[model samples]
Target: MAVIVTGASGFIGGAIARALADRDETVYALSRTDPEIPGVNFQHWDITEAAPQAVQSLAAKATAVFHCAGISSVSADDDALYAVKVTGTRNVLDAFPKARIVHVSSTTVYSSAEPHAELWEEAGPKDPSEFTDAYSRTHALAEQLVSRIRPDAAILRPAAVYGPGETMFMPFLSKISKKGVLRLPGGGRQKLTLTHVDNVVRAALACLDVPSAAGPFNIGDPTPYRLKDAIVTHFGRMGYDQVVIEGVAKDKALVTAKLGLKVKGVFKRGDRAKLFLVQYLQSDRTYNLSRQQRVLGISTTQHLIPSRFQ
Candidate 1:
């Protein structure tokens, strides 16, 4: 039997594929572009379209399907997110009816219009339509669909995933830093529950190997990190020195972001970038990971923290 990893070209998906390949698993990686992992086989896949014929044969021998073939762009058209996340999820479910579904969703689906000092394992919002961005709404729709169709399938809702090749937080930090000064909302003190790519892969693979890994699971590192500390550590790891971190009041950050959104189409992802900066830095979205620790047996990776954070 084989493992099918969608979005294998992406950060989290590629990591999952590489981990599986390293473990000598037969991996079929599907993505718009080939991830070029040494041993993983690549197949061209566009989630917007129907499942391709060339890869459909693998389903008969597929033991698991990691549905990770979507993007999380706040500026992405609502219809587009729906097509990729909601409709595309439906297609993946239909195509891999026999395989164990491990859908990789994001923590954004948790309603975050307001600040959260503490967050734990529970369904986030009853109404995703209330969300201003399509990223959360569309993902919520996908989760609802998955839970309805395959109640026993594993659903992983990871917080702002940061590591090598990440498109969100990592890029935001890099793009906004001017010389050495980096300004962030709430002084970047928002203790965000972040998932390292390694932890995410561990949770996903554990879904296949452990029976208790069913239902929706919140996966992240052992602890939450302040946004400022995360940024400093990231830059420091790259040998950056004298990086000055500044904090903008949460209200001011919100105002600036709102103003940026009013500008029309200057940068396609500008709204996404601005909104993400404020929300990630201002909101305190931390989770109680004991559920994942108990279910996934995550104790082994406690030593995975960077030496600096330790």
Candidate 2:
């Protein structure tokens, strides 16, 4: 069976394509840029526009498709994000009407508050306020579009993903670790969850033939850690002496200045720094993956801090 993977140049998509190839499955990867990964057929197609005729032609032969392409950052252009996420999904579904789609989503679709243990698939509310960011809103819209077009599609909502090749917190952590001074946006007690790359790939593979895995499912390590603790562990593992700094009234002016300069492009002129800091420092987010474990038989065993980081 041939599999088509969108966003194959990205971290999660690339990992998924690599895993499928390792199992001897024929894999075709579609991305705007040619990825350096070997063992898969790479096709250049811009998902933002109408589905390329070449990609549409290949869709009829694809047994499965993993739609891993979407904008994840607040810095991305809003109209372009919607086009790629919402309209792009529509175009792909139109091309492959019968193909099983694994629409990779984000756990941010859930409420920012801690969810109850009973909050499983089909149990949580779909209210818009549950989502935290514009990225999540677009992802939710994309998932809804997929369901309308293909109700049998599988939805995989992973928590904040972290692993090798991760550019998000990894680089920031590296920079802070080198400086020996780590600053939390607020007091840094917010809870956070992470999905390791290996576990994410495993979850994607398990959904390939699982008959009961046709609904939305959350995927992540069940373990939750405070932002302060996670930062300390990450830096300590790198052989650095970590110092946590919380902004005080005395340092507020200096902190404000730094944030204003760093986030002027993304946020409005006045509150850019404050807005950027709150996303990392003040928010408490976590997810429940019981539905995934029960239906897909996939669970995470590794801690948030992997052995390699140690």
Best by lDDT: 1
lDDT per residue (tens digit) for residues 1-310 in model 2: 6898998888889999999899888899988887767789998888877777888888778989999987645445668778888888887788778788898887656554443233455643256546544565677788778877888988888776777666455445455433556555555666777677787888889889585588788787767777676666655655546665564332464466466656774655443223433444445566667777888887775555646664
For all predicted structures, in order, the TM-scores are 0.92, 0.82
- The TM-score obtained by model 1 is 0.92
Clash total of candidate 2: 0
In model 2, the Cα lDDT at residue 29 comes to: 90
Q: Which residue segments of model 1 deviate by more than 4 Å?
A: 239-242, 265-270, 300-310
Off by over 4 Å in 2: 112-133, 172-178, 235-277, 280-283, 305-310
Q: Quantify all predictions' global Cα lDDT against the true fold.
A: 0.79, 0.71
The per-candidate count of clashes, in order, stands at: 0, 0
Error of 1 at 118 (Å): 3.8
Query: Model 1: how far is 246 from its true place, Å?
Result: 0.9
